[model samples]
Target: MTLDVSEADHQRVSEAIAVAETGTAGEIIAITAQTSDSYHDVGLHYAVAVLFFYLGTVAAWPPLLDWTWALLMGWSAPPSERAMLTLLLGVALAKFLFVLFVMKWMPLRLALTPGATKTRRVRRRAIMLFKAAAERRTEGRTGVLIYLSMGEHRAEIVGDAAITAVTTPETWGEAMAALIADVKDGRPADGIVAAIALIGEVLAHHFPRDAADRNEIPDKLIEL
Candidate 1:
């Protein structure tokens, strides 16, 4: 549960995660990630929204800034404080819409399984527990997402079920250890992901995605 991640391996680990979105957790589901600059995303959307909102303010400057401030903060403010609220209102609206639309809607549309949800929750718990335990023993995020982002010499167990799919846990652990070594030793993320996807494929061969299809896990995951 506890591990270390370093600074140099962040992108590699992130890329691996982005590509590892192929399987189901509880029953069968997919998860994915992508690199993003949220600051700019907020700024861009807010810039446009604010431009329009500001135009509305100009056309109908009926002292509605107080109401706008109330909407942003969930409380009212007097008109005397309407000077710099334009940017704030625009940014808040844009951010709320983004979270509601992209973060919320898109994931629901992905048709994730209850099993996948459980796995994700368990993954969070494991990581958090690792960090808490590490806090009892180590100095940093040895088992936290920070370590994953850092891409330290650490191997992650996706879950017990994931490991169970493999015939040999011993070999699986060894491969994971080797992967940790690879990342720590400066191997690229794509290569690391390729190695994992290959392992997933092998496991699928034995365990299979449906376990009934007798089909191989698609190789597409490796490309990610």
Candidate 2:
């Protein structure tokens, strides 16, 4: 879900938020992030895995060790134990470095990352952002964050303590489903707008607008 988010899309989301907030005191904040995490640690883990797998292969196959030794030192006498150890270390290091370098590309790194890891990372980031930008920000403590992570093709809805007290995470299933559907079809902006409308409905029901209600969070889509 690479963000091709346009100004018109942003305007539509802003307008959707405004309309949603008109009927509720809940402050809705929408944010779209290119990625939730860099996953450099995951890359390092991958490199280490590759290194170990290579070592294991060499250890499991005596012929492979001989081949590697020959490749490193051609037509020479059988290497000493110290030389073999150095050769294994050197080759393993090269494999590790090569994998690490390849993982520098974002798409490849993300593709190789496990789905559960991506989901967890996306959710974690959504919560962190919600805490920073929306949680307990409104007068009624009814702030909701609609977070979209394009890199992971995932979305999350986080409500402030006031809203969460009356509703469970499952309450946002419809909105999340709509968002995932639209995102899968490459309509990220439309997905966000639709999700906002649905979330607005929930907020209006759970926490209706008050006479003195004021907007605490900006009603615009943030792109990162």
Candidate 3:
């Protein structure tokens, strides 16, 4: 959604404004697209956790029965012999391994990459410019990731496939929806600047020119 900009709201975002970026100098789009894509994995993990709870507890009868038997068995072991250590370990391991796809590795798969969001030159421009503006970078061979930002709140994702111009309300909405969908589908923020430019074009027709933009030059892309 476009940044809400009532006078009071502007003041709030001006204060709360937070920008996030990732990837490397040459891999900004890859980083943003990846970051956008990560939300899905987070959601997937959330779902799997629910399923594990249900399957491990309610769906199976054997564990409950085993536990009941253990309780009935006389002096199975000293009460002190049992502890939550195993349960704690299992939870920690699960969190470290599965359900943390981004945590592990999902490589910066850029839209510029085949089968990426959109590979058209225009799309690539949007992705590149957006990342460049934000100064994204990939740290190294390791899967380590970072987000860098200056004074930005709204994010846009643009591509050649994106509408040529944000000339109308419907087009504006489409642009907004696309970025949100990218996040839903786990895309990146590389092209977001182009998308915002497109929106600015739309606003130009109806609203007064946006007050002077406050966004500053992004820091140089680095291994972050």
Cα RMSD of predicted structure 1: 16.4
Q: How many steric clashes between backbone atoms does each model show?
A: 5, 0, 21
Q: Report the Cα lDDT for residue 145, model 1.
A: 18
- How do all the candidates rank in terms of lDDT, highest first? 2, 1, 3
Worst 10 residues of 2 by lDDT: 59-68
Better of 2 and 3 by TM-score: 2
Give residue 164's lDDT in candidate 2 (0 to 100).
89
- Cα lDDT tens digits, model 3, 116-183, are 33224334443555445433232221111122111111234332211233233355566555445444
Which of 1 and 2 is the better model by TM-score?
A: 2
- For model 1, the superposed segments whose C-alpha errors exceed 4 Å read 1-152, 162-168, 210-224
Query: How does each model score on lDDT?
Result: 0.39, 0.91, 0.34
Query: What lDDT tens digits, residue by residue, belong to model 2 across residues 23-127?
Result: 998989999998999999889999999999998998788688778888768969878999888888898999999999999988999998999999999999999
lDDT of 1 by residue, 71-151 (tens): 756654453445445644665566556644553432332322233443344456435543443232311111111112211
- State which candidate, 2 or 3, has the greater lDDT: 2
Q: What TM-score does structure 3 among the candidates reach?
A: 0.25
